[model samples]
Target chain A: MEVHSSTAGAAAPPLSPGDFRELFDSVDAFLFDCDGVIWKGDKLIDGVSQTLDFLRSKGKKLVFVTNNSTKSRKEFAKKFGSLGISVSEDEIFSSSFAAAMYLKVNDFPLDKKVYVIGGEGIIDELQLAGYTGLGGPEDGKKTAEWKSNCLFEHDKSVGAVVVGLDPFINYYKLQYGTLCIRENPGCLFIATNQDAVGHMTDLQEWPGAGCMVAAICGSTQKEPIVVGKPSTFMMEFLLKKFQIDCPRMCMVGDRLDSDILFGQNAGCKTLLVLSGVTTLSALQDPANDIQPDYYTNKVSDFLDLLGA
Target chain B: MEVHSSTAGAAAPPLSPGDFRELFDSVDAFLFDCDGVIWKGDKLIDGVSQTLDFLRSKGKKLVFVTNNSTKSRKEFAKKFGSLGISVSEDEIFSSSFAAAMYLKVNDFPLDKKVYVIGGEGIIDELQLAGYTGLGGPEDGKKTAEWKSNCLFEHDKSVGAVVVGLDPFINYYKLQYGTLCIRENPGCLFIATNQDAVGHMTDLQEWPGAGCMVAAICGSTQKEPIVVGKPSTFMMEFLLKKFQIDCPRMCMVGDRLDSDILFGQNAGCKTLLVLSGVTTLSALQDPANDIQPDYYTNKVSDFLDLLGA
Candidate 1:
């Protein structure tokens, strides 16, 4: 059963088929990041379909986990199809989706306009959930002279302020948003995710929505109720969706901090993928030894080993 | 002249006009905030124009100080003209302009694209001073996915990261910008202002660029080279611009934490205005007793006493 523990304790070269098979035979459910492993900017990984089909044949569950707050469940499904991968909207878990659901169930002020500084996914979800969306004036010049009250109406009944993924987020917006929450002390503030960066193609990383959330939270002395992965609420939702036990299930992801930490914190097996942000070189170094219970190069590579 | 000698050390209502004049007679310059003091949205304060004109006739210097990082000197000039106030671009000093000038003179990074999650003042000033500007992708759909490396050939070569008035700044942007600077170890990061909240209208106080700057600086473990008012650098700049000794000049403004503190720290006379952010009550209370050399109901009222 202990197939190749040699690479397990250390960072090593890419695994062989035998090594992949030896490692993947122990996991039940799998979680994954979308951009780096299964595909890169619309091109599917070399052998992803076969890998998914093999996993499906073995009755293993697959869930796509992403910190990208820009895509909704439906949009993700469409994106997967466009990239030649078969995934239903239900197979995806997004920070934006979790935030929307959290808002809907918690009796948050939905009718009031949510000052959105993020992407289509967050905007679309807020709209779908029957919340009004507030936009800054059309001209960028207006932002300079625009006051906080002018940016958002002084409806004493304004609902919560939701901050999702916004790249153009600047000083005025931060100022205005902070003012609104500070002025209306009763309004709830929510951030979709707390990710600091996302792994892009070509091995470059970019800042994510979490950085903004942290900044505003620090200023206002208010922390957001994060709705994405590693949060027990989202994990609990996944458990209910698949009717799985939190203890016996497995959580597989490429990120050691988010995925592995989430798995460990939730009492599940953690399988760290070598295909994304966390590299084998980092894990294998004696100075840094945060080893996941299982290891694989990519989603498809792990599937090959799971056939045992 | 001895009106305040009886109550010099005793707690009293902030100096009345007669009491204020008896204690301090000579006033050289007047400083004002643009928003609530002079105008709200595109409208001037009732007596703001006439008061400035009278002061001009008396050959008194007037400078507008704003914590707003969204506009540059030129932009503020145009805004002032639109609001029926006579002003040259030089008469206005924004935190962005101050920070930009600081960066340019200090030779921080002249060639790198400053990933600006801020306003045009920050962008335009940096661009004019010979730095590239990084913004959200034009596609709009790829807004969240926008990365800065596209603007430059290599990420390591990034010289400095500047943050101003960006409402859409998120965790991704903050983390990436911070990491890039942290990894390089020599990259200079500058923030426009440090005011936590500014009153946009009588109704609300918006968070300022300082909040975001605080977050990034805290994360990176670096203090920015601040050029905003109240900073010693700014006092030095004013000293050089006006060719006046720091002790002989005066800084008149509405806020105590920034304006009054600036004067106090710079060894200049500080005049507190009742028309803006901090109230007379806050100044008199022992808990927040930040007494200015003089206090006036408004910037205009202070000008009246100057025989303008």
Candidate 2:
């Protein structure tokens, strides 16, 4: 295995096949950001399946970490199956799961319900964690009333307001969530992720969880406890759950802010790939503070390391 | 007419009946903020109708200026009629109308269309200004597909994305609006207002147009040109449209941030009424920068000056 050493403060150079093999050999566990590194939209990245197979053959622990809270871990695993990659639901750690785990770890009151301003994934996770959730897709439909004077029947049992990505996000959800946070004493404001945008395809990017989170935050004048990537909460959850050594774990991602920053905060080796939103020029920019330990063209480039 | 003097840079005390008469006599035109000062949640403030009548009897040019973009000028006029107040559509100026006027004044391309992420008010104003509008409530329904892979057929003719208060706001509208702004070359990004929350009633307040505007802004990283109160654009539009003398115009409102600031910025006398969102303590707070020229308990307080 080849080793190309560099100073800690400076940006690391792109990794060679042999250098990547050496790095891969050192790490026992791999945490991957799903969207850019493994797939873009519905299509899977070429050679990713073979790369994962090689990693598995080397007895490496593969964990899929994503900020997308629209789908539960089981659903994500189903998506993986459709993409021709075999993944267990337990091996996938989504932000929604992290949020649920957060509530569970905090010993949240079982009797109190959580008001959700998101999609099914957060609700599924909350339900799995033995917490009742209200105001998801079922409460997302537009009311027939002329004026927005629908008297929201306030439930005093609501102890938390959880926000994530909601395709069916409307004014009512925001209103109810705001009411929960503002009126309910000791009500927690939590966000699964604060991703500004999600790439649907190369040319198509849409507003993500951050938009909804920002909307709630803007109205309530309250900052939520974000539990997704870039926040140490998700990483801490993974560390506690899997008992993986941070030094021997590598975080492979395509985005600098969330993915690479999460790796840095998690005290893991980080690799940035050029296959997604980030560009080569962005990596070389002197203004950027967050730099990966190593970078390559794409996650599939690790296939060359296996050959080496 | 009565006169009372106060030290400069101090919070103005509530006006006496005689002092209010003096202020009223000085102004030939009176601009009102509808929600709090004139009415609150479908209920008209007592004595408001009589006070407006007295002002009209004195030959004051009354204009209903509101940041609410939900209803068009004609609709607003109808609402006024329902509230037992006679008003012409031309005398009502809303944020939606301001946005349309802004485009028209700037000589926006006639061939280009506008992509709306709002309600009917903005659409009506855009149409009235001879610009084709797309993607409002007509495109707000949730699509059948599970995945967010809606084929957003981009129209190159879309030159602006106008956002207002939309109860039917969904991911598709946000997605389509973002696409229009990012994909269309030099497409204008405009917001009617950035009001954080709107009061539906005493017990209910919901996220307003600002929440939706903030969502789009968070995703696009693009700052929109806001045309509502406190922006100066709306004031400028009103000033030019009516050819009103600034010194002879008095702005009456319940909120300090938008209404009072707007009046101050427009070089007009400002009257703050405690009938709305802000309280006496807030007005008296030294930390607050925006202050009105005159203060009253309510718009109806002016009635005492007229000996009603």
Candidate 3:
């Protein structure tokens, strides 16, 4: 493996197996990004499950923090179980859950509902937080071809519009969500995440929740309060929920813009793993603003420090 | 009526009935925006038919330029017929037709087809221009929930991705369009227009083509070549097709941003009609960049100019 001496005067260097001892000693909790660091698609990276178990054995707090808001925390936990990782819903903090908690903590009006432009995950979380609203696959409909004088019957009880990744997104959902935010006075606009694109596999990537969020923003000319990685909202949510000690926490991930930047914004040490979207060359590039605290070939490389 | 004295150091004033004679004598061709200038919703505004007839009696060339790309020129002509206005399909210049002409003039490969993310209008125009492709309501489908390892079968013959307003847009359309642009090397991206918000009525508005365009742009991080009002592309197309004298042409419209700006860009005199979106206060606002050469209450107000 080519070793990259970190530029930009940050002194970040490729962590040797011997350096793992200092990393383990420095952090009490570990936050991980899912897609690249742990697994790619349905298959887990080699030795990830064992490394996670080793971290747990070392009394390090393990938490899965993902910007993917298409699935609820329970669903994510189920996926983890399927992957042979024993994880509770409490240990999985998805952007959907962050949005729900944000609304609940803000004391969202019980009389008002959140107009959602997302999938079942966002709906389930909003329901769990006791917020009612319209959205999901059931709300999908073909919109009228032309603008007509016929008045549309809108749900006046809608107080917020929450957007996330929606595979079943249609014109009606966008139209109705736009209407709620534009017509309804003081209607809060929020997005579960702002991931520009979602990597499905090495050969496939699609528009993520950020695309849907941008559609609404383009139409309404209003920027939403984004609540996901890279934004401090999700980090703040995780910090308060897990009671994490800032200096003793480390975020480990594959992407520089979201995962590594998120860790830096959250006041935690960050470890960059080369198992996902970002490469060592990307980190070494002077144009990139965010840099992780350390770098490794993969998450399983930490096994060397454990003498496994 | 509140008269607006043009603020940007350009001398523009609301034309009085006496000034109408000189305005009519100055221009040989009349170009008009369909929606707020000629008709509002399904009903025609007062004196429009009479004013149009009066212009024809004076041997003035008539043309309709609209940003709405939902219908073909034939369809627009039919709508004009329904409104008692005598218009030929050749006289109508729509964004869809302009897109088709653009591809045709650029000598788009006959073997390749355009991947559309719009309605039948764009499809019809492309077909008329001898370009084959996919899009319209038939392509609307809910994409698979997760990105799978199963290879996505993409049409290799697609050379361009054209986006416009689509009422039946779904995830699969967005996914396929994104894949075509990102996966295919040198695939052209085009948008018919970028209208931010489409007004249905005073109380109802929906996300326009710009929203869908933004979704695709957000995913691919690629900006499209726009070909509609306010973008000089359509104006250049009209100028080439009709071979009209720019100084002898006058553009009449309701919106200052699209129609008026388009006329100014095409080197034509512009007249703003208050029958649609723009109000007198908006014209007087110092913040607006584009200004028309003259102002009138409505399109039919030109009847007084012809002494009808």
Highest-DockQ candidate: 3
Which scores better on TM-score, 1 or 3? 3
Lowest summed lDDT window (length 10), candidate 3 chain B: B1-10
Worst 10 residues of 3 chain A by lDDT: A1-10
| Pairs with steric clashes in candidate 2 | none
* Cα deviation of B250, candidate 1, in Å: 4.7
lDDT of 2 by residue, B190-301 (tens): 9998887766454456677878898888777689998998777776656776887877888898878788877877778888998887789989999887778878888877
What is candidate 3's lDDT per residue for A1-308, written digit by digit as tens?
Answer: 11122333574688866677887898889999998877777778899999999989989999889988878899889888999999999888888888888888899898898888887778888888888857775786545444455776669889999998887788888888888998899999998877767665544566788789888887777888988887767766667778867667888988787787777777778899988877778788887767687899888888886686
Error of 1 at A112 (Å): 5.8
Error of 1 at A239 (Å): 2.4
Candidate 1, residues B1-308, lDDT tens digits: the string is 00112223434355465764543335566556666567654556567888888867766677777767777788989888887777987678777677667876777655555666566777777677777766422111223444423432236666677765455555455655677676776777877767666565555556666677766764554677666756756555555666655555556677766777666677766667677666767778777645677777775674566544
Question: C-alpha displacement of A278 in model 1, angstroms?
Answer: 4.3
Segments of candidate 2 deviating more than 4 angstroms: A1-12, A142-150, A200-203, A281-289, A306-308, B1-12, B142-150, B200-203, B281-288
**For residues A82-195, what per-residue lDDT tens digits would candidate 1 score against the true structure?**
866788988888777777778888887655666654667876777777776563322122243444345544445546767765656655566656666777667778877766
Q: How far is each candidate from the true structure, as Cα RMSD in Å?
A: 7.2, 4.1, 4.4
Q: What is the TM-score, restricted to chain A, for candidate 2?
A: 0.92
lDDT per residue, candidate 2, A52-128, as tens digits? 99889879999988988888999999999998999999889999898898899899999999998888999999999
Better of 1 and 3 by DockQ: 3
